[model samples]
Target: MTGKTTFEIFLATVPGLEAVLCDEVRHKGFRSPSVVPGGVTIRGGWPEVWRANLWVRGTSRVLARIDSFHVTHLAQLDHRARQVAWADILRPEVPFRVEATCATSRIYHAGAAAERITRAIHETIGAPHADNDDGVLVRARFDQNVCTLSVDTSGDLLHRRGHKEAVNRAPIRETMASLFLRQCGYSGQEPVVDPLCGSGTFILEAAEIAARLNPGRSRHFAFEKLATFDAEAWERMRTVKSERIPSVRFYGSDRDEGAVAMSEANAARAGITDFVTFARATISELQPPEGPVGLVIANPPYGTRIGDKKSLIPLYRALGQTLLARFSGWRVGIVTTESGLAHATGLPFLPPPAPVPHGGLRVTLFQTAPLP
Candidate 1:
C-alpha cells in the first residue's frame, strides 16, 4: 500500500512507561499520537506502520489495525473473518498465527474465536498455519461484541535489536532502558554513564540515540513478509539520513569482566564502538568521565533477582556514597523493584510514577534532577 491513506497504528510498551513512549512517538513525528493504557496510538497508513517499526525505540511491538466488525457469535466471526480483504495484507504462502482475546462479549470463548479466524484464513487466504507465535500474528479482540483485527508488524520485540549476543544475569531490557533514559530527560544530546552496566543495554541505547541510528536498521520485521509489503518503498525507508557524529559520549562499567566484554562486543555490533566506552570496575572504582556531567542510569541487582535484601544494603550504600563523592552534578536513574533500595541511594528523587510490570515483578524508575 502507498503512504496516502490513514489507519490506526498501535505502539505497545511496558505498561508504566506508556507516557514516556507516547512522548517519544510524538517527538519522533508520528501524527496525533495519544497515550493509551499499555501503549500509544496514532492514525497513519502502511508506510507509517513500517516507519514506526523501524525508527521508534522503547516499543515492544507495533500493530496495524487492518479491519474490524461487530460479531456476536462464532459463526458471525467466521463469516466476517473470511470476508476481510486478507489478500491485501496477508500472503497466501506465508505462515500465520491467530491470537484472540474476549472481554464482556457474547462470544466469550477466545479459543473458539481463534479457531474460527484460523479456519477463515486457511479457507480464504490459503495460508499455512503456525502453532507458535511466529511470522504473521493476527490479533482478534472482542469488546462488547465489537471485533477488531490487527496484524503484528514487528515480528520480534523491538528490544531484541538483532544484537547483544551475550548478556549478564537479570539484565534490563533494551525497551525499558530506553524509556528510563527518556524518563531521566535524556534526548541524545548529553553524555550517559551506567556504572553497573549489564550487557550495556542503557549505554548502547544512549549511544544509538546520540548517533541518530535507527533501532531497526540491522533487524527485519514481520511487515516485510506480508503481501502489503513494498520492497522498493521499504528501501527508501531504510536509508537513514546522514548519521551525524554525536558530540557526546556514553560510558559503562561493570565489576565482571565477562559483562564488560559482552558490552564491548554488543557496541561493536551496533557500529557505535567509537562513541561508547566499557570497562570492568566496581561501584567504588567508578569515576566520572572528563567534561560536563550528564546522567548516570543503572539497573543494579535487586534482592528478588539476585541476592537477599539484607545482603544488598551495603551495595546500595556504597553506590550512593561513591556517586556523592565523585559525580556531584550528574543525575541518576535506577530501576529496582524495592523502594528501600532506591531510598538507600540518598539521591533526591522526585515522586515516582506507578510501578511497571517487568519479568513478573513490579519495577519503578527512580530519577533525580541534576544533582546539587
Candidate 2:
C-alpha cells in the first residue's frame, strides 16, 4: 500500500453505447482505456473514481478495482479473500456488503461465495459486514475461471440522482438519456426537444448539462466514508463557476398530464425549471420554439406493454411526418427497444446503431438528419 497501486476503474455502459461511452471517456481525458462488452476499464485511483462519478455522462456506475485472482474452488476463494489486504482499502468503522456472481466457475453458488467472502473480511480485517444499509459493496465477477474483485464507489446507481419522485411507465434512465444525447453530438449549445418525453428524463439531463451542473452534486458517494476520504478536496472539486439562471435551449413535451407535472417538479428540484419547458403535447402537435438546427432526442413507446402493434404504427408514422414537416434542418435521435417499431418512423435516418441492453431488453439508438 505504500507505492502507487494500479487500480481498475469500471465504467458501466448501455450495451450498444460501449463505444460511445469509451469515446466519451477518452474525450474527457481518460488515458489508455480498454473497452469490454458492457463497460470499459481504466487504470486509476480514488481521485479518478471521483472524477468519473462527477464528469462521466454516459456511465451508469463507477467501480474501483480492488483485487483479482483465479479461484477454482471455494477453499481457494476463501484463502485468497483472507489474504487480500482489506484493511488497507476499507475502514473498520464503515459497514460493507459482499455481492458475488459466479459463472462457469467451480464456485458457482453465489450465496455461498458471498458468505465466504464476507466471513473472510470479518475474520481477517476486522471490518464490519452487514446484510443491509452497507455503505460499500464488494462485487465478485467470476468468469472463465478468473475471479475479479471490485469495490462499488457509486452507492446507488448513478441514474438514481434522488431528484425525481415520480416516474411514468417505461421510464428511461438518466444515464441512457445522457448517452443518447451525447450520441447525437449534444454539446449543450442548441435546443433539445423530446416530444414523447416520459417523466422528463432526457430534457432534465439536457437542461442540467447545459447549465454545467455536475450530475452527482446532490447525492452522497460511498467514497465519502472511506479511510482516505478528503472532505475539503471533494468540496472544492464539486464547485463550478456558472450562472444559476436557466438557458432557453431545452424543451420537452408529453401527452400525459401527470408525466408533464412530474417532469416539471423534477426540473425545478434540479434548479433548471426556468430553462426547461414541459407541456402536454403529442408528437403530431409538437413544435420547436425556434428551429433552424438543433437536436430532437426522444424515447418513444415500443408498444410492448399496453398498445397494439397496428395502432402504434400510425403514431410512429405521424411522428415521422411531424419531424419531416416542422423540424427540417434539425438532428433527431430516437431510442426504442424494437427496431421494427423504429422503422415505422419512415424518416431517411441511418441504420440503428448497435443495440444496448437495458432493463432486460435490447434497445437501439437511431439517428436521422433533418428533412430537406
Candidate 3:
C-alpha cells in the first residue's frame, strides 16, 4: 500500500454513539463518511489514516480496511488471507498479531481463523507474531461467511491521550467525554464546568478542544511503524500546530481533596493548567464560575458504580437543586446509569440519547436547554 492509495478507513466508536462520531468525522472533512453498525466508515489514504488517529476525539480506534472476501471455511480463509499483500503493509522486522471474530458463519471458530491468518502473515510477509499484549494488530471480522480484514493503526486506545496518569473511581473515558461535549453542543466557544470531576477528563478534554490542541499530539500510533510510514511527512503532520490561548477557562470541583489534586495534576500534564481550574467542594457548595454562563456537565456517582442508590439520591437531588437555582441560562448535561438518579436532578432535561456502555454500565447523557 502506498501513501496515496485510497481505501476504506473505519472509525470505531461505542455502539450507541455512532451518529455522534459520524458527525465529528464529517465535520473534520473526511470524505464520504457513513455510519455503520459499530462505527463510522470513510474513504481515505494513508495520510487520512494518520490524521484520523491524530485528530479524532470520539473514536476508540482507527482501522485501515485492507481487504475483504467471501469465505466459507478455514481453508478459504487461509488462502485468501495469504493472498493479501501483507508485505506491502507489514514490515518484516516488526512483530504483528491477528485477532478474529466470527458471527453466524460456517467458520465459527475465531481461534482457528486467527491461526490461519497468522500463518499467512508469517509465510507471506515473514513478520513475527505475538499474543494479546504485543505486536501491530490485524483484525478479521467474519459475518455470514464474509470476512473483512483491517489493520488497527491505533496502538493504544485513543482515550489514553498519553497525558492522564491518575483517575478516580468510575471515571469517564476521554473519548466518551469529548463526544458527550459535542452532543451537548459544545464547540469550544464557551466555558465548561464539571462539578463532579474525577481526574478532570471532561474539563481537560474541553480545555484542549478550546485551545485547539490535537488529541493525539502526545501519543504514538501503530501506523508510525508500518512499512508505508514516511518519517519526515509524519513529523510534518504532527508538528503543524495552531494552538491558541482559549478565551474561557474550564473548571472542575469534587468533594474529595485527593480527587481535586489528581484533576490539577492531570491538567498540568495535558498542558492546560492555565486554562482550567480545580477546587474541592461538595455538591451543595458547587457553583458556576463567574465569567460566563456556559455549560455545566458532570458524570456523578450512580448507585451501581460507587455508593448505594439510597445514599446517592440526596446527592443527585442536591446537584439538581444547585444547577436549577444558580445556573440559569446555562446548559446542563449529566450522565448516569439510573433513570431515578437523572430524574432526581430535576434539571428540565430534554429527551436523552440511547444509553451507551461505559465501564460495564449503560450510561445515558441527560441534557437540558439553558436551565430555567
lDDT, candidate 1, 102-151, per-residue tens: 99999999998999999999899799999677759999989998998999
What does candidate 1 score on TM? 0.97
Model 1: residues with Cα > 4 Å off, grouped in runs: 1-4, 305-307
Query: Against the hidden true structure, what lDDT does model 3 obtain?
Result: 0.92
- Looking at model 3, residue 340 earns an lDDT score of 85
Q: In model 1, what is the error at residue 197, expressed in angstroms? A: 0.5
Clashing pairs in 1: none
lDDT tens digits, residue span 1-372, model 2: 324556778999777678878987898788677888888889887788888888787888898878888889999888989988788778887788899898898889999989999999888867788759655888998888888888888888888887877899878899888888888888777888889888899998888878878788888888887765777888888775553444456888989998899999998888787788889997878876874478888888776664566668888889988988888788888888776777888878786677877777788888986656
Give the C-alpha lDDT of model 1: 0.89
What TM-score should be assigned to candidate 3? 0.97
In candidate 2, position 137 carries an lDDT of 86
Each candidate's clash count: 0, 1, 0
Model 1 steric clash total: 0
User: What is candidate 2's TM-score against the reference?
Assistant: 0.93
